[model samples]
Target: MNFSYELIEKYKETKGYTQDKQVISDFEEFNSGNMSKIKKGTRHLTANQCIEMANAVGMDQKEALLKLAIEKSKSKEEGKIWSDIVKKISAACIAGILAAASLTGQVVTPHLRYRR
Candidate 1:
């Protein structure tokens, strides 16, 4: 899966894995063969492996899982549905971030915050 490839890329950069075999060895339950096949988009990481990857790479677990779902879909139609949902989730997350960053902490209102 492309997402798996991206994860491996991030892992390589962050953890200094120099080869596909090295990355595969670092994670449990993954075949060294598939690590190389992933670059060709002919292999997929298991769902649990996807979660592990997301955690390892500091990515959102839900997003990673959803993207994996898209890749795992049995049909293009099914993939479309998953793809749409992932896109909406991504957009919503971005909107939430933008809304929060817009003015949430920068403007001090009369209401007291309780961080202390």
Candidate 2:
């Protein structure tokens, strides 16, 4: 949910030309007056806003959205991979500990005993 101010600024500079002032103003007006208040600590960007901003910044909205989506998906995939690796390592460690305990005849219970 990282917000890239650099990307926003770059888009603004490219699209906020003199001739595009009216469009930019319209966008600002729409955002400030009509769009719902954004909640804190949330990463939510309206599709219309993205399109408008992209239009203002001389970039394709679909491309920007696609890039953002791809980045998010990649991060999620990486996290899942890391989580899987951690689970495997934890399981292996537990298995090793159990094996060591068995080798040392560390049986747990008053009712049962290790014959070997």
Candidate 3:
């Protein structure tokens, strides 16, 4: 499930903002009827809309919402960028592990190396 959706639902349920009219009033940027549809799962929010909703609801954790929006709004090219980043990180980790192993391999046995 989308993190933004989960967060919205959690907030609405916890804060007793279950009514469509109330939600619409609280988040005035959205259409009145759409609030009910969104709550009913018949409609969904885009990343930007979700962030706006979160802001309207006075959620203090803006960074979390922003990250979710970034993730949700990713285009195909953005996804490729994330994938490339993951690949680069994985390559670096592998290289680090190989370097560590090579260094360990060069360690002399206890009898061959002097101990302090």
Q: Name the top TM-score candidate.
A: 1
Query: TM per model?
Result: 0.73, 0.35, 0.40
Model 2 lDDT tens row, 1-116? 33223334555567554433343465544442222222231233456666666776676665656544443344778657655665676699889999898899995647867797
Q: Write the per-residue lDDT of candidate 3 for residues 1-116, one digit (tens) a residue.
A: 55555666765775688755655565546675665565565566655666665665666544444445445444877756655665676699888988887788954456667789
Q: What digit string (tens of lDDT, one per residue) describes model 1 on residues 4-96?
A: 788778878778777778777777777767776888888878888888878888988898889888877889999999989988987999888
lDDT of 3 at 74: 43
Indicate which candidate wins on lDDT: 1
**Pairs in steric clash, model 2:** 15-56
For all predictions, the C-alpha RMSD in Å is 6.8, 16.9, 9.4
In terms of lDDT, model 3 sits at: 0.61
Give the total clashing residue pairs for model 3: 0
Please report, as a residue range, the 10-residue window in candidate 1 with the lowest summed lDDT. Answer: 100-109
Judge candidate 1 against the unseen true structure and give its global Cα lDDT, from 0 to 1. Answer: 0.81
lDDT score for candidate 2 against the true structure: 0.53
* TM-score of candidate 3 relative to the true fold: 0.40
RMSD of 3: 9.4
Model 3 residue runs over 4 Å out of place are 36-62, 74-116
